[model samples]
Target: MAKIWVFAEVNNGKVDTAALEILTKARELGGEVEAVALGPGSTDAAKELGQYGATTVYASDDEVYADYVAQPAAHALHELVKEHAPELILFATNYDSRDIAGRLSARTGSTLMSNCFDILGTDKARTTIFGGATVVDVALEGTPKIALVRPKSFEPEASGGEANVMPVEVDIPDDLKKAKRVERHEEQASGPKLEEAPIVISGGRGLQDASNFELLDQLAGAIGNAAVGATRAVVDAGWVPYAYQIGQTGTTVKPGVYIAFGISGATQHIVGMKGAKTIIAVNKDEDAPIFQIADLGIVGDALKILPQLIEEIKTRKG
Candidate 1:
């Protein structure tokens, strides 16, 4: 039986949803599921992971691990993998996870699958593809296989039983220690994380200018639980934060309802949001590419349409 290991990420005492999603998938794979948390006293984090199907939680409480730097954290996880010799290492496809996955693969000489949507059974080996396209079923050519699963790909299952917690010591390699983090910056708290938002309103270059972005913010606020998103073009124009961009180069979102306002819907952008349960597109161009994928499409100017739509939504909610 191959043991499965999940790298649980914790920031400001809260476990990332992606970490729980990985643990849920690990449970489906069966065998002992061990979650590893490396930070300053992440015992509470480890216990929370146990509720999500982590049988064993390995925690490393070290000052060096306090800062969320990739090098030291990767080294710590690598050391844990070396000791446990798990068959599969699962990580969330966030920036940190991508960095760690690459390093772990190189260190262990294991196959790496990044940004996998679903893990289809492991007979010959674990199977996953990029952007949920091009199926690549691979059996581990090496002892351990590394995989970075996309966030929101799998729903998190409830944690059962108390997780067995243990403390582990990792010697940070001199080479890794050399790469030190000088500063840490945090983004101002936006209304809600785009991915976690139930309703999302996204804009593109069709909106015209940065000044038009106020319409997007107004519409989002009208919808209450809505979050704002931007297409690649609008993001490139410096209208919104890169984190709010949705596309191949940006965040992949799976919202209950996704509204693409003024977006032409490039294939790269569509690929990221095609998983949305219900898609509504509003673009002035009748031949916009976004219409093909949208459940409902309106051929009209976003500036004029948005204000009216906001009024209607407000009326209906009231």
Candidate 2:
């Protein structure tokens, strides 16, 4: 049996879905699965980890470590790994976890195998390369291998089993605690998070201007639960925020249904969303690269098509 230690990330005093997904996957791997829940938010979420198959939850509700600076939590994780010596440590590929994983890898002198889409063997993992044009399998050689998993790679399962929550203290060095959080501005979201949404409708620069994104918003409203996304080009052009960009430099999405409007399917953008279950592309260019991968390719002007689509969906639903 493999010995797995998963870093369970908490947000707003709840166990984040990304953490729970890995925890469930850890259980499926047939191992002694333990969860390390760090920061002030972890205290309220330790029990939630148990329900997802974290047999033992090592928790630290320290205020100093609450903010994710990649220092204090990395230090704590390094100490735990040294003492417990688990064969594997798992981290989500989200922002904070990536920072913590890199810091922890350097501290432990281990090479981090990252953005793994699947666990092939005991120490064998799979990831993409060459702008996601290739999938390669690699074997990790370190004593306790560290792996960062991609988001939306798996679905979360809740298997209600109470965990033995043990409160542990991690010493934060003066240097690591020097920085303090001043303010936070949460992103205003009306529907499911982009990574978690089942349907995603992404627009590109072909939409002409930022104001035209309202067409996407209206289409999303018609779809009822769809999320709007954009290509990096549109985002860089100041037509959309970086948060909405979907590409190698932005967010990787694996929605069930992915609709591309006016996107030419640049390799950078395809790297992020090629994993979507069903792909639909709409662009005036019949030979756009996006059509190569799209399950349904519509050669038409998106601006002319989207308005009709929205009305059609609304009418059908009504």
Candidate 3:
């Protein structure tokens, strides 16, 4: 069987959702799927990969990876890839994964595909272009094909098994450790994370005023387990922090339910949220582009309707 490797990123002593998503998809390719977990909390993260379909996990709990930037991790991964010679390596579309994948691609001179959302077996992967208006399938040539997959592209499923945890040690050369991470700060957020939330209520220019976002908060509160998101325009206008922005340049979300308020559906914005299972759009103009893809479209003022929607939800719960 072909060998496939996934770079499992660890966060707060657990495996990130993106890694599990890739692992779930990789197992379907009929390959012997393995994983590499590095940095702090990697041991704990590695332990969870088996249920998600990783047959083996190369784990390193050393703080050296967390202390330095991507260089140390990239160099170590390069060595492992050379020694193991896996046919494919998968990476999540995150900051650290992007850095490591790019560096590894250069080191190995292998075929590298970025921003991929789907993999068609071991020979090809699919991605979007022209702001997600066009879909392109890329051929995986060369010995060890590398792909950086976008999050939320696939659902994660557990196989109810345990991976063989293999402890590994790699010496980082002095030069590769030049860039050191001095400090890390986590963004404080209340409620469910936007990408992981089951229901996402997003506001755009139609909200009229930034202060009106309180309406979204109230609706989210009433709905329960919902997160608020905003378009790039609102984020650029400082209506919300960049962390709350959802679009091509921001977070991509694939929630079960996506409600858009006054968003005109710019191509860049659509690229990020089109993966949502269900889309409900509200706007004043019936001819808005968002109506084209929305499963349900409302021609009205979002600001005026939000209060009524919030009250109805509250009433239903009561």
TM-score of each: 0.91, 0.93, 0.93
Over 1-318, each residue of candidate 3 has an lDDT whose tens digit, in order, gives: 899999998866878899999999999998999999998898777768998999899999988888888898988898899789899999998888998899999899988999899999787999999878889998989979999999888889998879998887899888887888887777757999999899999999999899999999999999999999999999999999888889877789999999999999998899899988999999999999999999999999998899999999889999
Ranking by lDDT: 3, 2, 1
User: After TM-score superposition, what is the CA distance of residue 171 in candidate 1 from its true location, in Å?
Assistant: 2.0
Give the poorly placed runs of model 1, Cα more than 4 Å off. Answer: 66-68, 122-139, 316-318
TM-score of 3: 0.93
Ranking by TM-score: 2, 3, 1
Give the winner by lDDT: 2 or 3.
3
Kindly report which residue pairs in candidate 3 clash with one another: none
State model 1's lDDT: 0.81
lDDT value, candidate 2, whole model: 0.87
Q: Per-model C-alpha lDDT, please? A: 0.81, 0.87, 0.91
Instruction: Specify the poorest-scoring 10-residue window by lDDT in model 1.
Output: 122-131
Model 1 agreement with the true structure over 49-138: per-residue lDDT tens digits: 989998889987776776536788878777888778888788888877787788878888888876666765432333334434566655
Can you write out model 2's per-residue Cα lDDT over 88-112, one digit (the tens) per residue? 8999888788888998888888878
The per-residue C-alpha lDDT of model 3 at residue 16 equals: 82
